[model samples]
Target: MAVMTETEPPPPPPIRGRTLYRLRVLRHDPTALLGLVLVVVLAYLVVAPLVAVLSDAFRLQYGDEAHAGQAPGEWTGYYLWRVFRSPVSRLLFWEPLLNTLVVAAGTTLFALVLGGGMAWLVTRTDVPGRRWLAGALVVPYMLPSWTFSLAWLSLFKNERAGGQVGFLEAQGVRTPDWLAYGALPIIVTLGLHYYPFVLLLVGNALRRIDAQLEDSARILGAPRRTVVRRIVVPLMLPALSSAVLLVIGRVLGTFGTPYVLGLPADYRVLSTGLFQSIRDRSTGVASVLATVIVIIGVLVVFMDMRLMREHRRFVTVGGKGAMDRLGRLRRLRRPAFALALLVFVVSVLVPVLTLLLSTITRTPLDLSTFTLDYWLAERLPGAVGFPHGVLRGHELWEAAWNSLRVVGLASVVCAVAGLLVGYVVVRGTAPRVAGFLRQVSFLPYLVPGIAFAAASLSLFAVARGPVPALYGTTFLLILVMAVTHLPYSSRSGIAAMTQLGREPEEAAQVAGASWWQRMRRIIFPIQKGALVTGIVLPFVSGLKELSIVVMLATTGTQLLTTLSIGLVDYGYTQLANAVVLMIALLSFTMTTLTQRLTRTSLASGIGG
Candidate 1:
């Protein structure tokens, strides 16, 4: 009362909308505005398609007149019931679901064990040939998943599958049915191919941890095993969880591995089932299946987020510290080295060698029947029933050209957009807009590639406003691949920017340089290595990506991966193997060149 008597009646509290209006006026930030725009655009892109797919699932299609007993587009649980409760559900849903779970679980266990062990040996132990092992470990992940599947099939395909005799049979080994095509081979091949993801993630974490913490534990009388169990394992949980989630998400949505290995035995997982449904013109049921896959993907992502949030409690020492050199195994060193070498050979070298051998073989399993006919002949006598040799195939050349164009475009777009998004998020003062952009950019990472492809097809099939139908276009493929890979490049950008402090920019500003001048002359020059990494990693990934393009690509837009899949469908294994090898070689060369360029630039800059 006394204060009110002296003061002009307290200024009226701002109105709700007025407060927001004032806030916007005060935050005249270009980055924030750009981030808001990006977030909204991404959300619309991701969500609208999903909405369409869900709607399509519920509504009757033009050809659904056969299901006349059910009301068209009316609220009905018919699709779900038919897939989940009917007698046929056992074959369509339940059996495949069980098989999928088993394969997924087995793959996870194998990858974790193999990748984790190798990561530890390379990062923590005084292991011999550590550098060689480290580089070799990443090769499997770089190659296409189906490359491994084809290799496995080339070596293991039995008479049961109607293929030319496999390597085992050629050696007079009666390969068991399980080894040829089914759950067992599928799990093993996929696990070996995907384990490198775990190795990269976990090994990076292990390398970054301070050695002083373990030394301190030892000095406190903690035994090596105890210390490892209590300290190392706890510290690694975040990275481990990240790897696990990634593998699970990848395996769950994978179409190539199962198709190559499982389809021969009539083994069907959700992805295979969905593909069949679409192929059979059962669009409603396929959409429903895609929706289910999306739900599962969302749930896994939620769990991953929860694990990351709780990871902070496991922190050990934080400051810069030395890496401990584990004691040499001495007598065990040779055996350990041999074991690691053997694993590398089995996992990477053998499969690739097998593929190369198969590409030149006249027939699948008859090495004695070897021929350059598949590669050098203008036509393979039409016995293999293909129009041209692998070398001269017009279709193969066209697919390769298409792959390069699409992947190259996608990489450029993703890199630029990701860098912009990263700058906005890390530099902007508007927390809400920044956070929204960052999270939305990451949304595509959490969705299964197949499901995302399906959703994109639904969204772009029809025109919305000025955006015309992008269906069956290379532009559409480029857009989807770019958006799908945005998360990785965005992360690269954020890391790059964070490592590059604002002091240099501030110095330029103080000296009267404009923002554009500072960015062009100073910031970009220093950050070019990271920029290249951001661009090239996505390029490599997009080049090999299969699932994201599977549903969207038509004959006009067929990418190399899709072409390989088509060849498999047509039962042209040798030609398909040749294409797969070409794709793998291209990806490997690009990745190696990019990394070397980045490192050389960084080294030269540091020296200067």
Candidate 2:
């Protein structure tokens, strides 16, 4: 072969102008640019409202300022002093704070015990009816967590006339305040509903655990208790801690259950206190309460982070050799089955049966009082506003349709935005932009729902740039629902994307495929299951979301949640129960339909 001359390549083109260079970079690094844009938009939507609320904490609000002889726009600590230092602070803040802690801790412990036990029974033992128990245990979570409290009220509400007095009181049974209201009811109701969080987490961990580790421990002559203490507990801590964190966060923000259960006894959590302050137009006090809640939520997050950091060395199921060996419960299997079934009955069956029965009966437990007026009667002269039966009336149907439309649009938007966020955070090159986007997207989760609602009202009640005044608009509800529920979809997208190998996209990129083209043809198709889940979860959740919708929905923009709350407010107990039952049924139907259509488990989407 003839030797070739060693020639250097020609010199590169001269450097371009800054603007053109940036344009070129935008074209090439589309994901990075997209991530930057997402950060800005999310900051405007999430961070800006939160900042406005925080500022309200230090600023003089109208009512407080008026009372304090200060100008409306002036800054004052009058509200802060009243909340923390004044004599009334004990009644206004400290007592509520103590009650909140008690309820939260009690709910967490109850959920953990019940859920952890069920997880063990389902994942480890050869219990009869394991398949049925696995599903039935999670059914309560599909219902609004406060559905339990509502059912509890239907069965146990006492000391009030009319519909507020429960079936027990109507039957001349004296239901004690301790059982009928306050911390006990709140804990039990919230526990029954929230236990599924723990169940999913712990069950997933148990299922993924390597049986070989336990076997090795047994082979070394370690006792079962010793094996569990030394090996299993450490392995399961992540799931346990995750379950605890979720429960804690939920309790901090959960308004409905406590509000429904605690109201009779004048019990108040921070969420209800904030809601009350808002209702009374105590903007300064509301702001202070909201600030305290956010600070608590942040503290919880930091504690969770520190706990996770300490457990960094304890990774479970690293390779392919994991074997989920079922334990031989033998004679105890039937007992375990009974125990699991009992929990399902107590948590899911009871509340649902109560709601269903209450809806069908004019009065609870009196067969003679059974009537179809609530469901299908064309006219009920005794009824107010909704003088027709629920099914025959315009209100329920309209509200249901509104719920479906608004939540559907929101879910779709949430899914698409979630995908974009995941793409940027996982696939983009700009680490800081990705980090900011992730944090901002999740910021809404920490903020109390009512606080966010109050913030949304404050921020969007007026025209801002291209966004018009949205306070009484359905678009506002859709926007808030999409943003508030975005965490579910975004987390789902991130989880799916993290597992996805980038080789397909890299190959497409080498073939001169555009970013959108790759995302459309490859990423979207690959993660469609996750996208569907992202959409469905939010839809189901937003359907029964009372706090946010209650604060936002007006007469013309009534959603199912708002409609149900209205019925409750009007003392239409049967009508409200019927509406709540419809909500539960719809949520269950949607979840089942999604699973049937996509062949993906909702639990897998959450736990994965």
Candidate 3:
């Protein structure tokens, strides 16, 4: 009775002002506000450009009113009819569609075979120099996809496209159309560039595979091949599926590879067809084709979703005494080692050497002739359009500087925003908002870069809502690049954040720390590696980007990619090769520096 009389009421709930309440809510459950903001912003960025593209499909577009026989801005089915039912439908859509499927399929097959085999050899076998091969194989990925095509053309391109004959053709060996300009070259070039995607994904999975499972199967008298066919193959399906999807998506929209390789043979895929339509001022046709490509890309992604759902029932991540078991190559060891070495030489070494030789030679592939003009001459005696050497003036340096500035700003902002978006998606209280933010962030990856560029140009060329007109501005370039490359940073952020425990933040909260304080002191320090990864991947990729920037760059805003492409357009082959080499060198240098600074790796950072 005395205790009851003396007992005070339960402590009152803490009183908070509106600002403090808001801050507390943000610190505790940011989903309702911060997550919503990210979702809305990301959705707008991804969906607006798409809407801009699709809207052009239904309405009579500018410069197409005459062709559509309708007033501009009027809604009509003319574009749909022309693409699906008109007389040239087969030529305009069907053939290219068929060709697109063929290229995508071929490229996927090539990448899977080469990449999968290399992954096994490097990760699951005691191959000689496994460390070197592993690093060497990934080098090709750092270079632009078009670099392979350019190198291929330098060695295999005949006189079909005019200008100078390729090395072989110059040596009086006539390269057939099939080998030099069409599907074969396109497939090979793309495969060389994209196989690293497979290697990284599959090898990461392979390294994590449990040796106990295979050992048990072997002890049960299961043959080696049978164990692999059953246990290994099933375990690898998820990685294989992802690698296939990535390759297909890239092949579907890759402009430079197909454009460089397919032009001479009239081998047009959907991407090249889209480019042709836009170049020809057929905006209606371009929209129709672009929409179809996006549809295909979506279907591929959906199929992957279904596969992932099915794969979840089978777990491979954890098991007692699980460890990587390298296969005993035994008699096949050296042959396997040789095979891996050959791939490294062909995929990484050959193309780079070819580009170097091209840059030094007035007559490429001719060992007897060499000139330093492309690298350092003040003037060229017989040069036509670009009458000066590549290093003759500030043009090259200016382009490099612009590239560094634009890409640097974009990557830095992208990395920071990615971290915030990741925080919201993972730790926020709003499930719906989190999910939307997560998906929208990855949306740009499936969309073709050129189609994305077209959409951005259409949408941002004029002011809308809070954003002013961004066309013709360097900031626009930075924004386009950032959005286009958001998948890298966001994915990195989300992966890193998922592994981080909330205990640190909760501890900070218990200590009366604010949200920003927690993020700065705990989250940022732990995720420094991932932040560097996000920044570096985008910077490396952005340095070599051609398609997205081609449509967006204005006069006097030449980036390195645009500079190289300009030289190519003017038939400055040697100079173009020099610029390409410079791009590769810059990419390699930055990658190396970043690794030293952060002590991370391409394989680990990329996969994990």
Candidate 4:
């Protein structure tokens, strides 16, 4: 009678029937269980830490209770006031905010123009060394970003930070503050480091555009400029805008280049500001600054999503047989080639040679000061703890081993987890679960490395319920690295999974194969290349990763990146340069091997 009424609820199903229904669903789609598990795990790993950081910003930290006029864990707006409205706001927040915006804007513009030009030159023009140049330009990105900053200092440093003078300064040239450190140098160094983002994104997009669209416009009496403006530029906007956002996001979170170049002149961006707060043990201030960075990064991510949605409207509807042709440079070919060569020289050759030169020379660009003390010597005259050469020292070897062990394990974990996440996203029966898995896995991509590290430290450094405190542990380092870099591998997995059919797994299932069996035999073999890429790429990234590990690394967990940074902080310039060059060499070697094995370049694999 109750069921007969429209407003009344239906009778509850029998317990046996409910059990049978769930069993059938589970049997038919086992990924539903996997998806549910992944959702819960990722929610805790990804969302909980962010919530902790936000909570910490409002809560009075232990020592700040006196100033905050509240209990340690109680809520207070004192941090917000201190960061934004207090007397020290200019140094703590306002100046850094302004500097951040300027450097971000300037770096974005510089990377766009330089990277966009190179993309067009190689992908659309008949340049002499298009193939070679295309591969060479991405090399700058492979090296640690701070490599350029170190090289810049080697070439142009004055006696500002109170160590040794740079090559130009040694040669009787005075490098001014603006040129040597602060916003200008930050912009140039970060731009050089990040331009490859634009090149890869815009280059791929340009390659996909139909040449027929431009030809059609030209035939309709459109001038060359008109054709480019109307047909080419509009189609390229999505990629161009995406590149802009990518560069901006990077500029917002980047610490090494800005810190290395900006610190001497007392210049601070939001990233460096956050680092200082953390270093000074100002937990509330660090949380507030990190929150601001996370908010800006989230805005960028939302803008990217909106732009991606708008991208659907600009699709080119054409037949499968699309014509593609490169424009001939003709009389300007040599000049164009020279210009491209110069970019490679400045971006790659100069920085690397400078770093290498710095490692062996007491004074940069001074051949007379050359020595193997930095690399092979057992002892140095005036050096303190780091007396031995980089190779001969136990510290360098220990750090290198730690880098390999931690990052290597993290990469493997990321690859496997990413593959499973892709499986759930692409093949699961439950739409909501799949969507949740997809979004949560990708959320870390929007977070800057340093902010995420701070968040991870906040949440996981202390034990929660059954989990143990992870602070200062190698496992924590591995976990944070894996989570931060998961986006790259997960994206690769999703793309690869979309192309894979369930038929193989379905057939295997019919043979009474378990889910693990199907995945192990059928899915794993088919997607091995993607798995390897997910591993090697993260490994390469982790090798050069300073921002994330620097936030978390302790003495026992010294990675090559943190070790190099430590040497820099101790004013061991040559030792630092040597470590940096080794990191670059190791990263480059891994990337090269991965490219040959997987047939995927580092630039192409990223954000694709």
Tens digits of per-residue lDDT for model 1, 1-608 = 44545546867677997888867643443455667777777788766778877887777665665664665666556677667887788877788778878888889989999888888777777778877777877778878998889998888877776646577776788888788888998889999998887888888778767778888999999999998998888889899998898788888899999989998889888888878887786767777888888888988989888998987886666555375445467787778778878878888898888989987776654668788766777866544546566778677788889988988888888887777777877887888878777787888878888888887877788797989999999899988998888888888877787787888887887797766677688877887776777778888888888888888899988888988888777777777888899889998888788768776321121100
- Tens-digit lDDT string for candidate 2 (80-115): 898999988987899989998998899999999999
Report the number of the highest-lDDT candidate.
4
List TM-score per model, in order.
Answer: 0.87, 0.90, 0.89, 0.93
Q: List the residue pairs that clash in candidate 3.
A: none
Instruction: For residue 355, give model 1's deviation from the true position in Å.
Output: 0.9
Candidate with better lDDT, 1 vs 4:
4
What TM-score does structure 3 among the candidates reach? 0.89
Q: Rate the local accuracy (lDDT) of all candidates.
A: 0.80, 0.83, 0.83, 0.89
Candidate 3 C-alpha lDDT tens digits along 1-608? 44545667887556656678778676665546777777777777788889988998898987767777889999989999999999999988999889888888888999999998998888888877787777778888888888898898899878778777789988888889898998889988899999999999989878777888888899999998999999988888888998898788878878888877888789998888887887787888888888888887777777777877876755765563465456679899999989998998999789999989988887776767987777788877777766777777888889999999999999998898899888888887778888888888888877878878877777787788889998889998998899988988888899999999899888988898877788889999999988888888789889999888887786678999888877766667678778888999998888888778778677662222
The true-versus-predicted C-alpha distance at residue 182 of model 4, in Å, is 0.6
Candidate 4 C-alpha error for residue 544, in Å? 1.0
Q: Please state the error at residue 31 of candidate 3 in Å.
A: 7.4
Show the lowest summed lDDT stretch of 10 residues, model 4.
599-608
Q: Give the TM-score of candidate 1.
A: 0.87
Candidate 4 per-residue lDDT, tens place, 11-113, comes to: 9999999999999868766788888888888898899999999998999999997887789989899999999999999999999999999999999999999
User: Residue 415: error of model 2 in Å?
Assistant: 1.1
User: Sort by TM-score, best first: what order?
Assistant: 4, 2, 3, 1
